[model samples]
Target: MSNPGEIAAVIRAVLEALPVDALRAANTAAGESAERIAAATEGTGHDAPREALAHIAEGIERTGEALAGLGEIRERLNAYLAVLVPGVEAMVARPIAGPAGKRPITPPNRRHHLNSVGRKSQVREENTVILPGTDVRGDLDAIRRGEAAWLPDRDRCLVNGRLYGVEVPGTVYPDEGPGLVKLNRSEYKALKGLIEARGDMDSLPSALANNPAVTGADWQRAAEVYEHHKDYRSEDT
Candidate 1:
């Protein structure tokens, strides 16, 4: 019912508002963006060079094992004792035992463990001193080499109640057990008084060292042992 001029004008207005290929162009651009993102993610993947990483890990493990072996060797070396018998060559290396006794035992690692055990046994032995039987000579020897203390209490002598002073073998404490030798209440009190009086613990006499007798080198060893056993009193004391 409208005139041709009016109808043409409405058609042109509708066509002008619609853009050609705009939706298709938008979809193409979106697809390209998605593809680019996928490519970037694949390129950044950490899956390459796994063999190199594995090799690095293997090297680290080998290094750790080697270090552990060196540590064992060091421990053995520190605890090794010189050959006491004259003309005997010092052990160049710890001896190793072989299976079925058929193979020659010369493995250093085995010797190292044996030496470690022997060192511990020696220390344990040094901690105990038999009284009365230990004799004056023994007492002097213990003072020089062992962790020895004397409880000369008249009433508490291991043998006769003669109450004569005798140095007995006793553990240094904390590190060493009370063992066969012990300090009586009176002895403990005396020792406490002496140590407390001194400003420097090293000034205390060598007899007071964990041992009654000690070699010259034993002085340093005695100081280290007593420093840990500073709380001298037994529970009852």
Candidate 2:
């Protein structure tokens, strides 16, 4: 017999225990390395240096995406705890502590990185190409300056003369939309393992039996994982 209260406590502990700061530090180190590589290879015409820089850039982007996903999980987990374990949300809301005696690095603005994907170079100076006649121009300017946030109700709009889209706050995908289930990395691996064992995602169960990694995960999570896995394969292939 499992207690929901106890389970919630365990979840809170694990979330707090995550080494988010360490991951950020590593990502910062990689970004610095990339900068050096880019500077050194400016006109050398060397393939190796450019290749290395590309790999570093891809890694930095992936790490940023993973951090964004973890943040979403933390927020949702806190909301879940608020209902089952009362007051835990407030306690967990405090920023997680980092390594002792180390000054935390300020993370770069991720708004462009999140949407750029392979289009990293397009993340140029903010407002460098504003659309002259769009209704959302004011909104875009505010968002770019960090003075305001994009409204959840807002959809595709022009920013800097380019069409852009926003992921609505708290928007949960319906097995075919953007991946937003609360499953962590290990649980995601477990779900992938199950799919492989079954030889296809169509045969996977809604939930993993007897697996604590996915105690609170459900069908939507399984579907999203399968979709994302396939998408990754297709894009890489």
Measured by TM-score, the strongest candidate is 2
List candidate 2 segments past 4 Å from native: 91-237
Model 1 steric clash total: 11
Q: What lDDT score is found at residue 94 in candidate 1?
A: 23
**TM-score of structure candidate 1:** 0.17
How well does each candidate superpose onto the true structure, as a TM-score?
0.17, 0.40
lDDT, candidate 2, at 67: 57
Clashes of each: 11, 2
Global lDDT of each candidate: 0.30, 0.43
Q: What is the Cα root-mean-square deviation between model 2 and the actual structure?
A: 21.7
Compared with the true structure, what per-residue lDDT tens digits does model 2 show for residues 108-206?
Answer: 223222121221233221211111232343433322322221112323221121233433332111111112233444444444444453424444454
RMSD for each model, in Å, please?
37.4, 21.7
Task: Say what the RMSD of model 1 is.
Answer: 37.4
Candidate 1 lDDT at 136 equals 33
Predict model 1's lDDT versus the native: 0.30
